[model samples]
Target: MQPAVTERDLNQADVADAARYLAGRIVPTPMLGCPELDELAGTRLLLKAENLQHSGSYKMRGATVAVGRLAAAGQATGVVCQSTGNHAAAVAQAARRHGLAAVVVLPPDAAPAKVARAAAAGACVLRADGDPHEVVRQVHADTGYPVIDAYDHPDVVAGQGTAALELIEAAEAAGTPLDALVVPVGGGGGAAGAVLAATGRGIDVYGVEPYGCDSLARSLAAGHRVPVTPAATLADGLRPACVGALPFRVLRDSGIDAVGVGDDAIAHAFRLIVTHLKLVVEPSGAAALAGALRVAETSTHRTVGVLLTGGNVEADLVGRLMEGSAA
Candidate 1:
């Protein structure tokens, strides 16, 4: 068998190549600026509007690349993956675009909108109460289909990095290069991708998590991979029990920092984004801005870039959050 791939095997070039391959296939989401948010944070904030991306999240970037590769090989009858929400929808949509079937395993508590979106995209959606990874493995074993891990796969990581690469390039084109990049962490694919995209660019990368759901922070602090039973938080997408092994290696080697944000802060950021930016960012996406505000408290990052990861929140939750009554 071939030697197992590690984080070291992936690099910035892979991200650049992914970006090139995805040039016309995906949306080149806008880099938005909000004076109100900048004033509140006491620093300029460059928001990557990935919430408007295809499949309604940045997850589309990685899913497209992964699915396209399988389609190109002309062997996969279908693709399989497990996710809280966004990745499932993205994979389903990508598979549809490539004319391949998709099987997505989601947690029992996955958001209804996300589940509906995945199903609408023609994916066979399955809900499992146990570990999603194990369920994905079983699905692949039963169907003899290739599995595209949400975060661990090299192609996924490289594809996800394209979002950050686009943000970095957009900032430079506007003559305001990013000093810091903040992304809300789930399984850590996007954060690891940010690390790769911003490498050698003098950019400080940070991974954000909901308070008490901070597996990445704990893992970083412990100098090893650590798992946590995620706490109750509105940012459901960030509730992964632990960072992916590949992402942990990339983050640990890059010395990237992690931040923890509470629900209240995330809600506040959500309201602010909706009010000023006129963008309906989900709590998971808003958490990046919350973490950026915290980072700005002590850091000298004048211009920070935040990835608005997704916008697939439930209607009831959105209403509750907008009414300022969400717990």
Candidate 2:
């Protein structure tokens, strides 16, 4: 197994601490009960609409905790990171809150709107050529800024777990029981966080990834983290080449199961969200709902929480995806 995250960094205690730190920084997104989805799922269906979250994604939660730690430790000589999109925006916003400077290295192929948004968030956004992942090293070497890996860092992972923590707490307050949670996987930080949060709570957490980018699934089967050349799918945000070592061990050790879905099913999920739920979710966000649908057949869980991770897709892309979908 890959090296585990230190017990002290963003462990259970740190999760609580981060929750307290983020109470005012992040909004408590709703657990929207979709009756239409319930019918389709043949059970209680609730969505943790993190698309409504700060920075328009759950990354804000992790970003806040991670940046806050860095800032407090005086490691805040500014921070640098490479992202396809969402994580950069999250980091920019979080760094701003802590009065720290931020620079975002974005892949040339990243969505234009995402690049613009990151720049608008007070980050000095730079377009990197060639290998996107290598951009992190190049920027770090050139700028001497701390390189924040999108989903590999322990504090970030713990901060992401706050979403699950809040969702589970909300379920209790609402007098509803969360039998399971389904989250999308790319770098697996979110899924690892969910597993960490759900532990000993009798809630099963499962991760979903597109068939085109089944890095975590491949790694899980191989008993170690593995790399793959992700095929470009509609869910571009979930196209990481590999699951981070930290998340890989956490998911496996926590017994979280992962499932891969085809692009056809993800398109169907997009239709479901748009027509029935009336939510504007990106293709990557829709993966959680699609995974819930897949798990429903085999899972005995009644009330499954599906996390809509973000709503950052461009309208033109949605229109293009909708054109091919008969649903």
Candidate 3:
């Protein structure tokens, strides 16, 4: 028998309230009807263009709620987090708006454009020598600041659900009911929140990750959160080695499906999105669309909603990726 896994799940009772709070703040990114994508997927695909979202990713949704929750509680002394890029910028921007100090710990090799954005937003950017987990530990020790985990906290997970909420409402209002919802998975918060949102709506929720970073797939199979050694992948935003415990719990309890797409497929989808959908999305953001194409090719899900999560690629990187020369 397989060994039992260990982790905590967040059944956020206030997820609906989180959605309402975010609705009042953010620009509702569009659910674009792209027939070109539909043909590529061989299904009706409604692309939620979250690349246009604040902070250039869906991270803003959770960032707003997390920082706002602290501010509302009168405890907004400061917040710290670790990220590859987009989440750091989101937290920094949200912290600035709430009049709180923000510290973003990232690897020295973090994306230049995203790092610049976070710095511009007034976050004290730290390039830690150790792993992000260690950096977070030391940050807490020195600053005693509250840590806002990118996708592990319930507030953040609930905030991520707003995209799904918006997608559902927009699809319904347009007289098109969705059958499945697909998005990229990293820490799994967005996908977990999506499961929470799509559960009773009779919509199947799916999370797509880069093949080399298929943490959620392995975790679900193991019946617990399992760590992995990640390989180089273009989907940097979705390259976490382990699924967050909270997100793992939500996905396991809710029975949402997870899939993986190869780097080649992701590259193909990235270019297709630019040329056909005319949307500028980074590789991680394009993961869902790529996964949906795979699903449409083999599955019975006819109408799938794909969340394009971010577009904050550096200029040189984008050019190299588009030229198909990026390693």
Candidate 4:
């Protein structure tokens, strides 16, 4: 029998308030309507181009919101966060914009490009060994600075909800009712926020995770949060060990679904975005499209919104990721 899972559900009112808080900080990335994707998936597809966000990823939305809120509160102690990679850059960029000192705690194995990018953004990068869990804890213990948690903070969840709010607006502008929305779940900030924002908006929200790193999926099945044993997967951005408490609460109460996909499918979708859409997508970013395509192929949704959560892949990694496929 599976163990109990944590719940991370938020109500529509809370999501709306969060969106209001993030109104001007994060841009409303365009949602491109794709006829071809719809044709292939058997449903209208709205691609939320968060890949075009300021940090080339959706992490910026949460970072900007989180940092901005702190700044608004006149917190002068500066900001720090632990990340796989993207969140580091996002936090650094956001901190820079707010004139705040930034420190990034990164796993030792974090991509070199990610390290360079965070450093370029004026963040102090501290590399740690063993698991991400241990590293993040140590960073928090050492730095007494309030850690801007990547996925666990309520403000971060609220900020991430802004993405889904924008997507819903875009879909409404296109005069279509969205039946479902798909997002790549890492620590479940974006997925939890998306689910929270979609409530009463008449859209079903689904979180997609890499097969080997199905934290949210496992948590949902367990009816509480479950720590996932890390496995090798190319979707580094979504390889979280456990679903955050807030995200689990939101997922449990929000009635959202979780989908787990394989690495090969994510790679194929990554290549497809480059070849067909001329968009650079990281493996984790492609997970939503993979889920969207799968859902469109199998479900009866008339329209599905796929959030392209990030595009911060290193230039060299792109070649390796799309090696055998056409560019």
Question: Could you estimate the TM-score for every candidate?
Answer: 0.97, 0.93, 0.94, 0.91
Candidate 4 vs. true structure, TM-score: 0.91
- lDDT at 114 for candidate 1? 91
Candidate 4 displacement at residue 144 in angstroms: 2.6
TM-score order of candidates, top first: 1, 3, 2, 4
lDDT of each: 0.91, 0.83, 0.84, 0.80
Please provide the root mean square deviation of candidate 2 (C-alpha atoms, Å): 3.1
Per residue, candidate 1 scores C-alpha lDDT tens digits across 140-213 of 99988899899898888888999999999999999999999999999999999999999999999999999999
Steric clashes per prediction: 0, 0, 0, 14
Off by over 4 Å in 2: 1-10, 324-327
Worst 10 residues of 4 by lDDT: 1-10
Candidate 2 lDDT tens digits, 193-248: 88888878888888998886988888888898889989877787899889988788
- Name the candidate that leads on TM-score: 1
Worst 10 residues of 2 by lDDT: 1-10
Clash pairs (backbone) in predicted model 3: none
Worst 10 residues of 1 by lDDT: 1-10
Best by lDDT: 1
